[model samples]
Target: MSTGGGAHAAGLIRLLQSADFARAFTLAALGTGFASLLIGRTAGSVTLVTIVIALDVVGAAILFARRDELTLLRFAPTSLLAFLAWTLASTFWSFDRASTLRGWFELLAWGLLAIVIAHVRDTLQTVRALGDVMRWMLAISLGVEILSGILLDIPFPFLGVAGDIAFGGPIQGIFGTRNMLGFVAVMALITFTIEWLSQSISLRLSIFSLTLAALLAVLSASPTVLVIAVAVGAATLALALVRRSAPEHRRTTHTAIGAVVATVLIVCWFLRHLIIRLLDAASDFSIRADLWNEILDWVRPRPVQGWGWHGPWLRGDDASAPYPLNVINFTLDDRHASALNSFFDVLIQVGWGGLLLFGGMSVVAVVRSWLVAGERRSIVHAWTPLMLVALLVDSMFESFTLTGLGWMMLVVCAVRAGQSRSWRERIRDLAEGAPGGHGSGSSQDPLSGAR
Candidate 1:
């Protein structure tokens, strides 16, 4: 009777960690993502954000209770907590203390949400869930763009619509900017390619996904994203080749990479002037150069803690730098907020200390993610790292590191790539043989694995 009762209790606990919960939380995450693109502190959007936080709260509760697969320590360890703590502390020094404090909460909340996702997913489910999110987001974006451009011929206020295709658009799609749209397309291209290479989807679907991603990328007309796409594509191809090589020849792959890096460094040193000239050839970049010069002057005074935790390009009354018009000598009522470089944005917002922390975090994340992705040639290995690369590339031209999808992506990838543990994890280690846990008992029969 005791043995039967124990078995029944275990079964009940397993039921609490069901796939149904996974599905629910996944959709909740998607909804939060969609709502975050809006303009405001409006109640509706706030409600959606609350839903995301609530789901995270519930997820953490369930996993913690089950002693199933919770990995809070590995997911958000000392570095992560330190970063969050510092960010929160900056509220005291912010120009607008209330806003900065709120930002801290918002960022931490998203980080928690990421931990929930990373702990819930395994390798395959991670990829599949990623696929579902990107596929549907892209599909919906296409529909919305078409409707705004052709049918309604007006912007959708809720989607943060900038303008329609009738204007020779730099079409902003649902993301509210041409560059952001291109960023999504680039990610889709990477993910869809992985799906294709992995044979996770039908050939026709893969081809269609590839074509759609390409179309969106081109139509968005974002020079930065296009350039980044080329770099990422080259990297992907190189890594793919590395994966295809035999295990015995894998060492040669590292040798080739080292050689290429050396040659590139040598060439860069020899032709530094020409490289500068080539970079200067872009007209828009020249404008940014002019502004950056002025931005440098303003940052000189506060090189330690910075102007405050305040971010974005538009410096209001209490901003660290001069107004965009003052910086660039351009006479336009509209303003450019970000420094066109995320690194500089961090420098101006939080100072050298913040910059070092953020920059270090970014570097560590990319390296960790790269290692994880290089473990195998499968799309699973490729997907997360490619996204990290895209994030890195975009940060060069946009202050994306502290905002929206970029921040969320960083947290998820970092947590997933990490390998750490808490004391409570002993409970998990002991429960490894249980269902929903990962250990030697996992998926020995490929046919029995979850689809």
Candidate 2:
């Protein structure tokens, strides 16, 4: 009996540490975070929390089991850790300690999940996992839209879907809003494109996935989608050029691309009104502008340290809520869930200090990823930089990056980027007396799958 019990325990431990198990867990975590709104709405917040807690427990166990092989130095990005630490520190000064603590805990939960996936799987594996999740998510979203709009011809209030597909939709699908759906579709498009490029999935499936993503992205009718599409398309072209350039000329290519992007952005900013009208995003921008104005009014009072890190605005319980969010909502005469801008959201939450930390984290992550992608020979290397571009550009329009799936993706990309190029690697190489460290070898290119 004792032998049997020991054998069973050993089996369980081995199973948990297996590569297949890690991939599966990655899929589950991505799916949960991406589908959080649908889960929360359908199964209730309690169920959503329960699922997250369960995943957290499993992630902790897996990390613990693998602790011998993993070092703290290489665990996460320094900037990411600093930002998290600042957010945690904000609890002391937060308007509502309870809410702040909850927000911080949720933030840690998603971050942990991302960290685990980053440690367990390489970039290509992570991308493939994301591809699987996005495919299912996009398919189900289309199915739901069809059911609500074409077949039933009624709104799915439970899912926040307005059955608008029949009328050339602004369909929400399961993401709770057109903007969210559009965001997911864009992410899917990126993932599917990577999958196709990497030859990870069948050509037929890749084609279907791309078609599905494009279809939903259009049907969502999100103005943000247009901007994201243009940014991502331009980025794709730039990355392709960088990849094809000779090693010596790559730096020149990078500089030229940077200058062009900057000039384009400046031009867009100056012609913002014309572009807004062209995209029919005037009303959306106007609404966002008004809310941003109100948010600035709140941010002025707590410029340095802000009102503490209460993520999404507290809903339903005004009395128990923090000062500025409830106050802002009342003042605006609208129940604004967030500042609608991630930078502003961070600024309002943890103040200037937090915003700086957040900005540093983003910039470092993107720069590292971009450099790695440019130097690496594999197509999969391009995924991180492209996704980072999408996320950062989208952050200007939505607060999604502060929490949930967006936050997870950001952390995963940052960790992957750091793994490929970081101070930690330099220090380790110096310690081992290996000058210049390993240079673009197979060891360094762990993410370079199949190629």
Candidate 3:
């Protein structure tokens, strides 16, 4: 009976290892990633969050089972490894060991999710499946935002469930903050735009969804998100213009547009306070400046390793400092003081090495995605460059990395969507093990594989 039971168990494992099961697993991971954001801080720990965590585990298992079949990791840069090494090294000297450890753990989880997404999704069908999951996820969030806005008693509408309705409050559909909801909305907008452009679905439906997503973004009222949306839209239009002039200019046009957008965004961020003051909406700018300066001062003394993970930049006595205009109406805490910019947050906690790793990974991912898209010429390739531009633009003024759910979604999308290899590369992969520079199949020549 024991031997029979063992055989049954093994059979079940094999069944779970099939393509259909793998697809389901991927969907589950996406769902979990989405759900985790919705649940926010109330969901408790990893052990307590059974459903979402289970999905994450299942997704990880599915990828591990088929690890040998995919070549996704070959595209990742060695700088990523260096970044992880730097993060790990900081743990030993972190001023706040607990917070640092927690951050490191979260980073590790994100890295695993990225790898799994890249590995398990190898076909266009899988890519479509992933995209579908994203669409549905965004749709659900949009629906909640609309519903909550109608029902909630808050001024912001559909937000401000937790505590005071300060600083735009929490959208609370599944995330902890309004900013998180805004990020998700931005992501949804990007996906919807891609679908609309690709003509993958009916034009009417695409337009409706895109419009709905844009409305949701407006309602979320995330200033950083608004900035990203405008920048991405402008970048897309510019690319469209350049591509119209010459057919061969498509790749060059996208690259040039991306560079221009990045440069403009970086410059704008450096003068964010001035820009906001000029616009007569200096609230967020003032708050960001206060936090930025404090974090910068905190990090200057320990440039290398940082204060070590969630390191305390502010003490209880520091809470009396003036709050940013945006959050001035609400009660401020020391924690809020240190939680300004994601880039600065990393710099203060993980040091310059961490910043380099974080920045380098993003650049590498964007470039690699562009190169792959140039070769593949598929919807994903087109979508990735646009999405990367959006993310970079958004990161300038927002702390997306610490936003939890949205960050996970971005990482998953980036890994899976950006993993598309070129046709030539695919052919080379298949030919690597063939005999006499050709496969033994009586169907086609070795060179035919390149096509």
User: What lDDT score goes with residue 117 in model 2?
Assistant: 92
Q: Give the per-residue lDDT of model 1 (tens digit) for 225-256.
A: 66678669867876776777787886788689
Better of 1 and 3 by TM-score: 1
For lDDT, the strongest prediction is 2
TM-score, prediction 2: 0.95
Off by over 4 Å in 1: 1-16, 38-44, 66-68, 71-73, 156-168, 244-283, 311-334, 420-451
Give the poorly placed runs of model 2, Cα more than 4 Å off. 1-5, 315-321, 438-451
Candidate 1 lDDT score at position 158 = 58
Report, for all candidates in order, the number of backbone clashes: 3, 0, 5
Give the C-alpha miss distance for residue 251 in model 1, angstroms: 6.1
Supply candidate 1's per-residue lDDT for 47: 66
lDDT of each: 0.65, 0.88, 0.57
Alpha carbon lDDT of residue 183, candidate 1?
A: 82
Task: Rank the candidate models, highest lDDT first.
Answer: 2, 1, 3
Relative to the true structure, candidate 1 reaches a TM of 0.78
| Alpha-carbon shift of residue 132 in model 3 (angstroms) | 4.5
Candidate 2 C-alpha lDDT tens digits along 1-451: 9999999988988877788889889999999998998898889889999999999999999898777767666689899999999999999998689899989999999999999999888888888999999988888999999999999988999899999999999999889889989988998899899899889999999999999999999999999998998999999999889888999999899999989999999999999999999999989899899888987888888898899998888543344337788787777687778888999999988999999999999999988888888887888888998899889989999998988899999999998888788877778778899887642335445433431
